[model samples]
Target chain A: MSHVQGDAKKLLARVRRIGGQLGSVERAIAEGAECGAVLQQLAAVRGAVNGLIFQMMEGHLTAHVGGQDSGMPEEELAPVLAVLRSYMK
Target chain B: MSHVQGDAKKLLARVRRIGGQLGSVERAIAEGAECGAVLQQLAAVRGAVNGLIFQMMEGHLTAHVGGQDSGMPEEELAPVLAVLRSYMK
Candidate 1:
């Protein structure tokens, strides 16, 4: 598989795992687990999820956006930038 | 500002706007706006937000992770990877 697709799959898997954690946290909250403990676990889950997000975004920049010396042709950057702009909107 | 910092600030601003959009969506649902319209707007907001996230991730990979021809030295990729791993957890 292409590197981008592989990376995306890895990210999706990680996200799914985090989704499970979120569900568990929700259940914990519903069950009235100790507030502090529950909050702590929830915070960890959030951090983990955010971290994966950060990495995925970073991966996109490297693999697609082609910064200073990406070796990728300038023309290729347009479609990527176009996608980014669409997202920003 | 450093390019990385500038990009991050722009990303954060975009995210905050999306957060507002989410809040508005909640308000719309609370007030009983047409479900179809509200869901449509909510979907648009989600798409937009995800798009920005995609861009930001791409930027991080380019600026920090240093793909194939990155003028960045190998050692530089370590700390970034470390941080990414932390996030993954």
Candidate 2:
């Protein structure tokens, strides 16, 4: 496993937070919370999820693509980077 | 706007890739790809999304929660970390 995988416990902790945020959204909807408030919570969830995505990409770049001992050539890394770039947007 | 926001271009590139992946899945369904093939592609998209989510969470931790000189104390960070843990799982 890679370093990220090795740190799964920490990573999973973050994921759980996202889930909890989602549950809050669900509850807000069910409880008839104000539309604006619900929307804000939803946006927060989106931002949090985006944060997680960014971290994973950084890890991949550091450990797999740009690591000092990485055997991956620039040509191969280019396409992966391209995909990563788009996903982040 | 912090370091991550400054690097938005690269992050957006990754987001676009996810979009493209979703498009491919759509096309596969429209073209009547074999059920197994379609399912496999869908799974790939799921993994890609999960990867993106992981990246985002890591960035939040380093930049917002644990950055050098951050004023936020561990007590505040703990609740955030707890939420993240659940989201990851």
Candidate 3:
């Protein structure tokens, strides 16, 4: 149970929801759904994935940054954290 | 077809890929995948979906913030576009 595994059940649930959202998007197009509705679904999926990313990103941060116990000095850890932040969002 | 519907087949394919990525993520967790590997998959899905979001967001901009023919003046469109930009990414 590494710190990177943050509530695996929760993560799996979010992934399932994202999968369902994608399926809905497909169905929307097939049914000749209007553009506004389709676009809204896509945006919703993106928001869900972004939330999942942030959740996993937090796990990475806690493991590598390892809080007070981390042997890596601030100067070294700062750049790593900076790079991670840039990518996560 | 209104401007908001940009290549439905292409959009559907991307959605499918995102769905597949999510499925893979679920499998990884179920199989007791290592933390680093799971995180990598999460990041990959995020990138794929981000690309999809940009595509749809572009459609939204073109349709609503429509170019020269749009009646919306700069003052009105500016804030609208700005708000869209803030949300899309």
Each prediction's Cα lDDT score?
A: 0.64, 0.57, 0.74
DockQ of each: 0.13, 0.03, 0.38
lDDT by residue (A1-89, candidate 2, tens digit) is 55455545555565567557656655654555544454466456566555555555556566666766788866777788677766654
How far residue A3's Cα lies from its native spot in candidate 3, in Å, is 3.3
- Greater-TM-score candidate between 1 and 2: 2
What are the per-residue Cα lDDT tens digits for candidate 3 across B1-89?
Answer: 65434577788888888788889999997776877898788878877776776677666666667677787655775676567666544
Question: What's the true lDDT of residue B39 in model 1?
Answer: 85
- How would you class the docking of model 1? incorrect
- Weakest ten-residue segment in model 2 chain B by summed lDDT: B29-38
Local accuracy of candidate 3 as per-residue lDDT tens digits, A11-57: 78888988899899889876667777987887788778767776776
The clash number for model 3 is 0
Q: Candidate 2, what DockQ?
A: 0.03
Interface RMSDs of the predictions, in order, are 6.5, 13.5, 2.3
Best candidate according to DockQ: 3
Clashing pairs in 3: none
| lDDT per residue (tens digit) for residues B1-89 in model 2 | 55345544554555556556556645554554544454465456556555545555555565676755788865777788677655643
TM-score of chain A of 3: 0.73
What is the per-residue lDDT of model 1 for residues A1-89, given as tens digits with 9 covering 90 to 100? 63458787787888888988888889998999999988888888967766675566456545543556654455654554454333322
